[model samples]
Target chain A: GAGVSQSPSNKVTEKGKDVELRCDPISGHTALYWYRQSLGQGLEFLIYFQGNSAPDKSGLPSDRFSAERTGGSVSTLTIQRTQQEDSAVYLCASSLLLAGGLDTQYFGPGTRLTVL
Target chain B: AQRVTQPEKLLSVFKGAPVELKCNYSYSGSPELFWYVQYSRQRLQLLLRHISRESIKGFTADLNKGETSFHLKKPFAQEEDSAMYYCALSGLANFNKFYFGSGTKLNVKP
Candidate 1:
């Protein structure tokens, strides 16, 4: 892809249901990131995947949220037992991890998830 | 603790007016800071980074360790510059984990 792409631009799910958001990062990018943007709260980092190393999941808000990057190209964010508070925009970004810490993340159009 | 903070939710400026978007971060060690902008209906894109210390589209930001701030500024605003701006930080403590502040929407009116 020319840029980071996200699937299902919008998702409406009932409370307690599970939702999955997908991201396809640019080819050859070594780093991928997931973030959640909501009212009051800013863009919150959820997880990061870089070249097969253990994902940095320190930013995940809770245990219900999890993500996996397959083949280092596509990534999926799964929110289990979704609650109303889960309503927000899920953004995915990718970057070429440079040697000089000059990574400039390119973000996707984001998936707007609404849990009712 | 919230690593990044963007104090203004919205900033309205007239065309040709000076503009400034405030951002602050809290980190013990040196952190990488960046400014990202999202145009209407477009994906978020990097506007600039403190590391590069370069200006883009006439906008610039300086990392102030003394004040713990990285404020985006432009001498004159253009209507096309109206967009959502986010300040971000990547810290050594959470290497590769980037933290973003609540974005400030800049509305440059004609």
Candidate 2:
């Protein structure tokens, strides 16, 4: 893709429902990241993926929040039994991740989830 | 834990006035800070980073390790500069996961 692309640009689900968000990163980017942003709040770290390495899942808020990346290209974020508090914008980013600490993240348009 | 904080939520300035967006971070090891801007209805994009030490769109941010600050500055503000700006930090253990500040809304009046 030309840039980091996210799917389901807007999702409105009832409480206790499950929702899935998708991200397709820029071609050949080695690092991918997921983040959550509440209305009028800063983005919160969620998860990270780097090539074929095991993903760093430390940032997942809870067990309900899980993400998987396949073939190191596309990633999906799943939220089970979503709560009202789960409503927020989910963002995805990808970086070249070559210069050790010089990784610059480019973000997607973000998915806006509204839990009613 | 690595944390990024942007103290001001809203800032209004006239065109051609000086503007500064304050950002502070707390991390135990070496710190990498970045500034991202989101124009109206546009995706969030990287503006600048501490490592690059380069200015983009006439905006620059300098990392002050002693003060734990990475404030973004511009000598003269333009109407196009009106947008939401975020400060981010990446740490050693976070696998390049960037921690973003609450964000500051810069409004430039014509």
Candidate 3:
């Protein structure tokens, strides 16, 4: 009955510091995704994880952006050496399956990350 | 690359008037289109999907392949309908990822 959830609702850090955003997908969801929303870029897909197979890292902006899903449930998005441009709202979503169509994704409240 | 476009950054309408939010997408294959909405102080949630062909909260969107558009429409706008609406597309080729538009902020004035 619970929807997706994210931690660290708000985080403020200095440039060059590392920040981690966590997401807890809904129960039995096999697909998890990370997205960033900001004034400049709008909403951009960062990464996705499906089951235990290899994760899709193509959407990641740079090498500093990385994510990992432990045991196919919880996911952590880590941004190393955070830059001022990395300031945005980090949103997490999950779906029942990874099929190509009609899969409704439920989103979390998102964590607002501010890199000063 | 697939892309979604929302030409209008903001759309304002009077309550009880017709409202339409335009959305256009670029993709080669049959695409799964979705409308997501976020009210003030609320999380993003799915409003409707084209495949389902169902209307939610009196809002409906028709996917036009010829024009590459899927505009959200409601005959009578309500104050509660004001929010940020995003058009998203997931192509069959890249089903794992979704391309979202810049989002249109709808303001319903009474």
Which scores better on TM-score, 1 or 3? 3
Superposed model 3: Cα runs more than 4 Å off: A98-102
Global lDDT of each candidate: 0.89, 0.90, 0.90
Which candidate number maximizes lDDT? 3
Q: If the candidates were sorted by their DockQ against the true structure, best first, what order would they fall in?
A: 2, 1, 3
* Best of the candidates, DockQ: 2
User: Runs in model 2 with CA error above 4 Å?
Assistant: A52-54, A100-102, B92-94
When candidate 1 is compared with the true two-chain complex, its DockQ is 0.68
lDDT tens digits, residue span A1-116, model 2: 49899999999999999999999999888788899999999999898888745456778998999898889899999999999999999999988877555466888999999999
Candidate 1: list runs displaced more than 4 Å. B92-94
List pairs with backbone clashes in candidate 2. Answer: none
lDDT of 3 by residue, B31-102 (tens): 989999999999999999998899999999999999999999999999999999999988654567789999
TM-score of chain A of each: 0.93, 0.93, 0.92
B1-110, model 2: which lDDT tens digit per residue? Answer: 67898999999999999999999999888777889999999999999988788999999999999899999999999999999999988764355467899999999999
**Over the stretch B2-110, how does candidate 1's per-residue lDDT look in tens digits?**
4899999999999999999999999766798989998998988999988788999999999889999999999999999999999988873345678898899999999
Clash counts for the predictions, in order: 0, 0, 0
lDDT of 2 at A31: 87
Per-residue lDDT tens digits of candidate 3, residues A7-42? 999999999999999999998888888999997455
Lowest summed lDDT over 10 consecutive residues: which window, candidate 2 chain A?
A97-106
Instruction: State the DockQ, from 0 to 1, for candidate 3.
Output: 0.65
